[model samples]
Target: MQKEIMSNTLKILCADMVQKANSGHPGAPMGLSDIAVVLSHHLHLNPQDSSWLNRDRLVFSGGHCSALVYSLLHLWGFDVSLEDLKQFRQLGSKTPGHPEFGHTHGVEITTGPLGQGVANAVGFAMASKYAQRILGENVISHFVYCLCGDGDLEEGISYEACSLAGHHQLSNLILIYDSNKITIEGGTEIALSENIARRFEAQGFDVFECDGHNFDSIDLAIKSAKESCKPALIIAHTVIGKNAVGVEGSHKTHGAPLGAEVVAASKEFMGFEKDQAFVIAQEVKSAFEASIAKGMSECEKWKKSLSQEVQSKIAELQNPDFSQVQYPAFKQGDKVATRVSNGEILNAIARSYSGLVGGSADLGPSNNTLLKNEGDFPKGRNLHFGVREHAMGAICNGIANYGLFLPYCATFFVFSDYMAPSVRVASIMKTQVMYVWTHDSIGVGEDGATHQPIEQLSHFRAMPNLLVFRPADANENIACMQVALEMKAPSAFVLSRQNLEVLSPVSKDQVQKGAYVILESENPDVILLATGSEVNLALKGAEMLKNQGKSVRVVSMPCMELFSQQDQAYQDSILSNRNKTIAIEASRGMEWYRYAKVVIGMDSFGASGKGDDLFVFFKISVEEIVKKAQEI
Candidate 1:
């Protein structure tokens, strides 16, 4: 009786929201009414202790069905008020067009982009398994259930992440696919007709099919998933609009709300007293209250365990001093590409840090993101992010937001454009997600313009609160990683694909300080500011000028974000206000306007050629840099 009442109440809420806003996708909300009832009423969740470390995580990868997710939250014991539902699609309401994390009580991750949520669920599931391995099975083991749509299946990233999940045998991960046979454009049959169940079976998931409206089938499938020792995917067959009389079983109902007349008729069919908004019976309220109480009891036991376990683990790991520690020491004059240096530094940090996880977007080998002898995060330390760069960025953000792990994702620097959105979100959220981007410029030679990053650095630097760092040598790379690891904001460690001689003058302390005394000032008439590969060119240019009886200073400004954070006096000291300054880099000049009198940079696109030829073509070589500095 309680289940019936809650399911009907959910239907009413879905109808009310869609009708009031005259917007939103109501089909899935109506179709999955029973699934929502079973998950919300029976699934383990503690609203009062939402941050409880061991609670199960839920994500709606098919976020267009947000009305269903929010209605479930409201029906369960979440803080989403009925009034909030009434204000759906309005400004400042918790119930928005789609679920947004941190804006709502129970939303674990912000999921609007389809396949990303599935990929993030893979990360969450992987983290859960690793947490149990590190912290003990009894300490932290919880399920990660994600509801996906046919759209999610088609997004390409799903295959990449899901393939890895199956390979790892992440039995704790459960996917509920809403196979309603519809998309925004038209019936999914128009473009998609492959057997999704067979595909999941091939990918090594325990696949199940059930009637969407049957609570018993949904409950049994979920229970089976929890018991299975492999990842599971329930392809629940459902109608597009189950109760909408006009468009039931059709794509027309996929995204639009039924009109006022049809909504009233649907309310009557559901046996509602009237077309009331946010209607739920007192009996349903009592049921949820009882569920909340039960969760509270579970919370008490978990709380005691977590307190003791976290402390003991912290002691076991000998938690490093997180309060502004010194950078790793680096001797001067070591020639090393920043990419190789980055790998060395990350492995060094991992030796002391237990929670750090690093991976590349299927480019770990090329990007040099693998930790030394670090087994594939295989249910443990490293992650293979597949080739889904966009989802990889967002998954890194999700893992960081979990707060239990320090997450890092890598890809070629040119692909930073694909990851810009998630990276920006990480910066905005102030999450410590590190991005290891190599092949930072035209140095990616022969791969042509498409593989080279010409304007990405400027794009990242233009974003507020994001650190864009390109270290010159192995020492600077190590220092840059250290600073990025310490920052609570998103940081990009840009590296070259080509080998670079490790410069001998940059110290670890100087790199940590951002702009360091790479070359001492000789009361120079001019100063050379450089980053990444151009720093070596700048040094050479300075040496040539010095030979010509010119006083010059060269500063390696690897991290603009860190440097800008230093006091004005420090900045003025490194980039002398009186001295004529020339800033050089192998990328766009957009962010160099304030620090240089003349910026010798790549303002135009790059093309395929030998690395040396490319450098000459762009005129970013040492000779060109020296000529530009002399003119300035």
Candidate 2:
């Protein structure tokens, strides 16, 4: 009886909110209310302490149904208020069109794009497993629950992440699928045909089904899923726009509001006052309060019994000892690839800091991202993400948000496109999910244009708050990493495939400044700017120019995003007189125009030849830089 009232109250509140906003998705909220009732009984969350480490992680993969999210949060004793519900979809409101993690008190991970949330949940499950191994079962034990819809299951990332979850045998992960069979265009039959249950079973998930509108059946399904030894999926067959008077089972209510009259009728049908908006009866609030009380009790018990070992583990991860870190030193003039140095530096950091864990997307051998002797995930530091680049990014974002560990993922530089969406979200959330992208240019020999990343450097550098680092040599790579370690935001470490001669030991200040004079000449005829491998090229070109009696100042701009943030005075000091400055990189280099006038860069696609030959053929060589500098 209490479940019925609560579900109906949520339904009415959701319908009225969309009606008021005249924008936002109403159907999903209406469809999933019944499941929410069962979920409330089982999910462990403390509104008073939303960041409770041992609390069950709930991810709304179908984040469009934010009306339902706020309604549940308000009833379950979260800070979300009745006024927030009334302000749904409004600018500057707590109830935005989609749930944002830090923006909303109870949101675990910012989820909007369909399938990424499922991957995020898997990541949480993985994090829980790792935390459990470190802090012990007494300290970290939590199930990760994700509420997803048909649209989410249809996305390719779902398959990639789910497959990895199955491979890892993450029994604490449960996915609740709202099988509403509706899309923006109409019924899902228009695009989907495969049996979802069979697919999940094939991916090693224990599957269950329930009547979405039946409270007992939904409860039973969730209970059974929790008991499963494998990652579980509970398919709830639901009616889209469940209680809307006219569109109850239709897709018309998917992305838009139900009309005022229809909402009123739906409310009345659900035993609510026809005109009442954001309705939550005292009895329903009390019932949700009971659930909150139970959760708080569990939270208190967990907090009171904090073991000394648990405290130490948590403290270690929360505040990693950066000073204890022994950074590998590269000898000046030693030919070492940035990727190789990055691997050594990564291992060096992991050896001291147990809080850092990550892996490459099947490029461990080539990318040099393998954490040696750090076994497999959930037990060791190395996480084998296989070839799932998109899921790898999203999962790393999840791990970063899990609060105990810093996460990183690696892949060939060009394939950053596969996971670009997740990277954007990481930037938005300011998740410290480092991207170690190697084979940074036309230097990916024989693999051809498909493997080379030309525009990727500029493309990511343009993204707000995402620091893109292209270290000139091994020592600069260390400097870039030094800056990356202290940042709370996402960063991309772009490493070269070929060896670059170490020029000098770079100071953290130099890398933090994003650009510094690597080689300087008095009253320069031309100021040459470059990044990554091009810095060495620029230096070589500058030496040729010096032999010909032309003065030059060569600058290594490792990170453009950081460089742009510097004061105009500092920027002028590095890029003095734009007309006399030439930016050289193997990639597009279009963004360099902000600091340099003449740019020596690749305008055409690279070919399948030796990396050095391809560089000269593509006119990104010493000769090209000198010619462009001379022309300037």
Candidate 3:
């Protein structure tokens, strides 16, 4: 009876929040209230220390249900208060329309786009397995619970991520599907017809079903999922609006609020005073408080029993000591592809930082991202993410949330489109996941336009909180890697497939600052700006212009994002005072106009041919650059 009251209280709180805000979803939360009651009361979590390492993670994959999440957080005595709930969907409220990861105390990952949270939960589960292998089960053992709806399963990323979870045998992961038949358009039967349980079973999940509003049925389903040897999915069959009087089971309640009269009547139907709003019975509050206290006690006991090695590992993950890291050295004039250089630097760093783990999206060998001789992850240091680029990115974000792992995912630069959504989320959350994107231009050769990246660099550069690096050569690649490791935000290292000449007298610190003068002449007539493969062309062009008695300066601008962040004075020092500035790259040149008078780059897709032939054909060669500089 007390549990039923608490579930009703949650439904009322959700309805009140959405109705007061005059916007937001209420139907799913109302339907899923009983399940939330069971999970919040049964899940092991520390409200006092929300960042506790071993605490179970609960993700609201159907993030429109944010009101219920906020209510649960407030009930569990996290920093979310009643006032915060009242401010739902308002500007600057902690209780935003969607649950943002870092913005909320107990929120695990920023999830709003359907299926991302499902993939993120898979990542969290993977991290748990890896952490347990390194830190021991007693130290890192915990389950990852996710509450998703039909929309989540409808999205493709969930399928990719869940398949990987099953393949890895992530038994610690449990997904609760709120099988509410309604979407904003209407019933899910309008579009979806696949048997969800059979689909999951095909994906290697242990599937179960239950009455979503029945406490005992929900409890039994959860328990059975916990005992499964594979990743589990509990399909909680439910009404759209479980208990609302006028709108119960109606698609109208899916997004809009139940009107004031309907809400009052719904409260009365649930055995509460018709006019009462956000009312919590004393017994309901006491149950949550008791559960919270028990969680805190368990956390304390676990912390006390942790071994010194586990403690040290935790400390190391939180505050990595890169001072002892010996970065690989590259000699000047070495003909090395930046991708190969990345592989070398990555291996060197991985050898020292046990927390550094990642894999390519089945392009490990080609992307040069493998951690040499470290083997595959769990028992080894490498991660084999297979061909699933989208899931690989979200999984890396999940590992980043673990607070002890510096995760990275790799793919060809062109395929970044496949993972762009996850990358955007990582940037929004400020997770320090590195993306190693190789084959970063039309220089990909014979593979043709489809495989070569023309606009990807600029696309990523435009995204806020993402550090995009296109290193010129071997030494610059190392410098980019160092900056990526130290950055608090997510970063992408766009590397070249073709070999580049290691420039003489490279300055690692200058590269870290985003750009530096690689070749300078006194009182230059033109400033030549370039990045990646084009930097070599810029130098050669500068020499050619100098031979024609025009003083020229060549600058390697490897990271436009970093350059833009530098102080105005420093930016002016590199960009100002030239008679004419020309920017040269192999992709779209529009982004370069800020620093240059003329921009030389591709405006169309590349053709299949030798890389050198394609470079000249696209007019990104030294001779073309020299000609363009002369014309300027």
Candidate 4:
């Protein structure tokens, strides 16, 4: 009876929050209330220690059900209050329309875009496995639970992430699918028809079914799921708006509030006074208090029983010291592709820091991202993410959020489009994920226009909070990697497939500022700015112009994002008044206008040929750069 009242209280609060806002979804929370009640009772959470390392993670994959999560957090006493519930969906409120990870105390990850949370949960599960392997099960053992809806399963990314989870045998991960058979538009039967259990079984998941509203059935299914040798999926059959007075089980109840009269009648029917709102019975409060006290006791026991070695490991994982990291040095004039340099630096970092873990999207060799000799992940440091770029990105974010690892994902620069959404989420959440993107330009050669990336650099540079680096040579690549490691936000290293000459007298400190004059000419007539492969062309063009008695300065602007963040004084120092300033790169040059008077770059797709031939054809060569400089 107490459990039933607690479930009803959750539903009433969710309905009231949404109705007061006159916006937001109320159906899933109402339908999933009973499951939430059961899960809340069983979840290993300590409200007093919300950041406890071994605590189980819960992701609301169907994030429109934010009301339910907020209500549960409030009831469980995690800083969310009755006033916070009243302020749902309002501007600057802790209770935003969608659950934002860092913005809320217990929200795991910023989830709103359909299937991202599911993918993130997979990542969280993967991180847990990795942590357990390193720290031992006694120190780190927990489950990753996600509440997803039909729309989450319908999205393609969920399939990608879930497939990887099954392949890895992440038995610690459990997905509770609220099979309410409804979407905002109408019944899910209109679009979805696949047997979900069969699909999951095919993906190597232990599948189970239960009545969502029945606490005993939900508990039994979860118990069986925990004992599985493979990842598990519990399909909890439910009715949309399960207990609403008039609109129960109807599609109209999916996104809108039950009218005030319906809400009052529903409360009355649930044995609550119709006149009151946000009311929690005393028994529900006692039940939560008992659970919280038990969790606190468990947390205290875990802390007391931890060995000194395990405690040290935990401390190191949480706070990594990168200041003493010694980076490998590069010789000037060495003909090395930035991708190869990136691989060398990655291995060096992995050797020094156990927290560095990630893999390419099945492009390790080409992207040069493998941590050589570091076995496979969960046992080895390297992760082979197969060809799933989208899942790989979210998985990296998950690992980063796990608070022990610095995660990175790699792919060809052109394929960044496949992972852009996840990358955006990382930026939004300020997760310190690194993206190693190789084959950064038309220099991809005979692979042709389809394989080369012309606008990707500009697209990423435009995104806020993302540090985009296009290192000119080996040394700059190392410097970019160093900066990425130290940065609090996400970073991407756009590396080259073709070898570049290691520029003489490289300044790692200057590169940290984003752009630096590689070769400064006294009394400069023209300032030539470039990045990646074009930096060498800019240098050669500067020499040619200098031979013609025109003093020219060459600047390697490897990271536009970092450069833009510099103070106006520093920017002016590098981009001071000159007779003419020209920017050269192999992609669309519009972004260069902020620092240069003329932009020399590709305005069309590349042709299939030798990389050098394509560079000449695209007029991104030394000769063309000189000609343009002469014209200027």
Candidate 5:
């Protein structure tokens, strides 16, 4: 009876919100009401203490199911009010159509993009385990539960995360699939038909089946998952619209609304009073309120246990200092490519920073994310994010949100576009997730324009609250990494695919200041500014001008975002509009017009050839830089 009342409240809330917004997904919420009611009412979570260290995590991988989530949160005593629901999909409202991180109070990860939440759940599971192992004791031991749909399971990213979850045998992870056999396009059979349960089973998950609309079945399935010592997946078969009259059991009602008239008729069919708005039975409300105190009591017990554990292991909990996770000891002449230097620094940081966890988007070896001799994050130390770049980015945010790991995600710079939204949200939250992007420019020869990142550097630089650093040499790369390690906001390190020389004369301190004096010139006529692989070009070009009797200053601008934050006087000192300036880089010059007198940038797409030839074709050579400077 309590379950029935909870289900009615969820359905009513979802219908009202969508009807008011005139723009939202109603089918999923209606279909998933039973599961939502069961989890919110019966799961081992405390509404009174939302951030309990060991509280069960609920991630909605099928984010379009947000209506269902919001309804549950509202019923279960989050800050969301009736007015907040009324303001759904409106500007500045917390209850937006798609769940947004920081926008909504309890949304675990910003979901919207299909399958991102699924991967985020994997990260959450990993973070909890890592926290327990490093922080010690059972201070953090809770299952990461995810509610997904056909769209989520169909996405490639889900497969990637699931594979890693299976490999690590993350028994604390549980996924509940809402198998309604429908998508926006039509029957899922029209597009996809794969053995989902068998797939998860092969991935080493304990699979269960149940009737999604049956509260008893869902409750028992979740219980089975909790008891299992391995990751569990429950495929709950359900109707598209469980009890919405004519459309109750069909795919037609999966996306479109039942209309006001149809909604009225459906309400009658479900034995509800006519024209009732946001209706919830008093009995059901009382029942949920009764459980609130019980949930609070259980949460308090967990809190006491955590407090006791902290007291026993104060030293390990406090100074678990991971500030130096994956970096090398700072030295004057650390000669290595930015990518190589990144790996070395990351390994060093990993040694001390137990919370430093991350993985590559399937390009582990190429991305240089694997640590030497250090254990793979095999569901234990590091993360294996598979090939899902977008999901990997969002999941990294979740890992950071776990308040334990300073999560870093890696991949080629070009592919970072796919993961942009996830990284963007991380920036909004000021989560210090390190983004390691290798193959920074047109230097990725033979792979052609598809692989070469002509506009990627500019793209990252465009994002607000993000630090985009492209190091000139090995030492500068180390310096940039040191800065990333210390940052409180999101940072991206762009490295070259080609091996670069270890240039001398620049120190780590200078790089940390954002722009440094690579070569000072008295009475300089022009400033040659460069980043990444092109920094050496600027130096060589400056030499050519020097022989020609031109006093040229070379400045390595590793991080434009950081440099811009410097005092106005310092900015003027480093780069003056009064002084003729030539900026050189290997990527598109779209972002360089603002700072240089004449910008030598890759204006066209790259071709298949040797890296040097590609550089020549793109006019990214020191000779070109010298010529451009001479012209200026």
Candidate 6:
């Protein structure tokens, strides 16, 4: 009876809040409230200590139900309060339209993008499994639960992430699908027709079905899912809006507030005071607080059970010593692909940093991201993310948010388009994730225009908090990783497919400054600025210009984001912002306008040919740079 009342309490609060905001989704919260009540009993979490490592993770893939999220966070004894709930959907409020990880006290990650939370759940599960392998079951044992709706499952990324989750047999993962059979466009029958149970079953999940509002059935399904030997999916059948006068079970309630009169009617129907808003009966509060206390007790018991080795392991993950990493050395003039160099640097870091773990999207051979002799995830360092690029990026973001792993995902530079949404989310969350994007331009060679990246470099560089590195050579690639790994944000290492000449060693400290003069000329008549493969071309161009009595300053701008952060004085020291400044790169180079007066960039798509032939055809060669410099 208390569970029933608590479910209604949550529903009423959700309805009240949405009605007050006049612009929030109330349907999902109302529909999922019963399941949320049942889940509260099984979920292990301490609001008193939200960072408890052994606590089960809960992800709401349908973030539109944020009213439910804030209510749960408040009722479960987290820092969220009734006032915070009142401020729902307001700017500067803890309860934003979508739950933000750093902004909200209990949000595990930023979710709003459909299907990302499903993938994040897989990532959390995978991270826990791997941590358990390292610290033993007693120190690292936890389950991951994800509540997702039709929109989440309908997105392609969900399929990609779920496929990988099943392939990995992540037994600790449980995905609770809120099978409401409704979307914003009306009934899901208007679009989706797949048998979701069969799809999950085919993907190797242990599938269960339950009446969402039936407490006993929901509890039974959850208990059964917990016992499964593989990742589990429980489809909870529900209505879009379970209880609202005139609006019940209709898609109209999906993204709008339940009318005040209707909310009053619904509350009265549930045996609550029709006029009261945000009322949690003392009995319901006690039940929820008791659950939190139980979770705190479990957290304490787990803390006491932690062995010394496990504690040390946990500490290592929390405070990684980047200084301990032994970077690989490269000699000047040595020919090596930035991809190969980054692979060596990655292995070097993996040998020292146990938290450094990731893999490529079925492009390990090309991306060169395989950790040497370190085995596979749950026991080893490599995490084979399959060909699911979209899932790969989101999963890596999840691992980063899991609080121990410094995750990375790799693919051909051009394929990043398929995964840009995840990468964008990672940047927004500021997850310490690395991206190894090889074949960094038309340099992908014979793959043709379809496979070559033209604008990826500038597009990503434009993203906030994401350090996009277009390394000039093997040494620069090493420096980029060294710098990227030390920072607490997402980064992408745009590496070369073709071997580049290793320039004279640049200190990691210098690389941290973002851009510097790689080759200096006394009283330079022109500044030749380039990145990645074009830096070497700039050097040869500078030499030719010198022979032609034109003094040149060749600068390698590896990371424009970092450079932008530098003070104007430091920026002016390298760039000087002169009319003769020429920026050259194999990509679109849109952001170069800030530093260069003349930009020589890819204006059109590339075609199938050898990488060198493609460079020549695209005029991304030393001759082109020289011509541009002379004009400047």
lDDT of each: 0.80, 0.90, 0.88, 0.88, 0.78, 0.90
Give the root-mean-square deviation of each candidate in angstroms.
Answer: 3.4, 1.0, 1.3, 1.5, 3.2, 1.1
Candidate 3 per-residue C-alpha lDDT over 1-632 given as tens digits, one digit per residue, 9 for 90 to 100: 87788888999999999999999999998999899888876688888888899899998888899999999999988899889999999999999999998898889999888998999999999899988888888888789999999999999889999999988889999999999888888889899999999999998999999999899999999999989999999999999887999789999998888999999999889888988777877788878777557678889999999888779878987888766678777888889999998999888888788888999999998999888887786687688988899888888888899778888899999999989999999999999999999998988999999998988878888999999988898888877777777889999989999998987646568878899888876667899999998989888888788888899888899889888889999987787763489999999867888888888999898889989999989888888878887787
Model 6: residues with Cα > 4 Å off, grouped in runs: none
Any idea what lDDT model 1 has? 0.80
Task: Please provide, for model 5 over 175-275, each residue's C-alpha lDDT reduced to its tens digit, 9 standing for 90 to 100.
Answer: 99989998877789999889998999999999999899898999899889988878999999988776676777676676566678767776776668759
**Worst ten in a row by lDDT for model 2:** 272-281
Model 3 steric clash total: 0
**lDDT at residue 539 of model 6 (Cα atoms):** 89
**Candidate 4 segments exceeding 4 Å error:** none
- Clash tally, candidates in order: 8, 0, 0, 0, 15, 0
**Of the candidates numbered 1 and 2, which has the greater TM-score value?**
2
TM-score, structure 4 vs. true? 0.97
Report the error of model 1 at residue 343, Å: 1.6
Model 3 stretches astray by more than 4 angstroms: 577-579
**Model 6 lDDT, full chain set:** 0.90
Candidate 3 displacement at residue 375 in angstroms: 1.9
- Least accurate stretch of 10 residues (summed lDDT) in model 4? 288-297
Q: Which ten-residue region of model 3 has the weakest summed lDDT?
A: 503-512
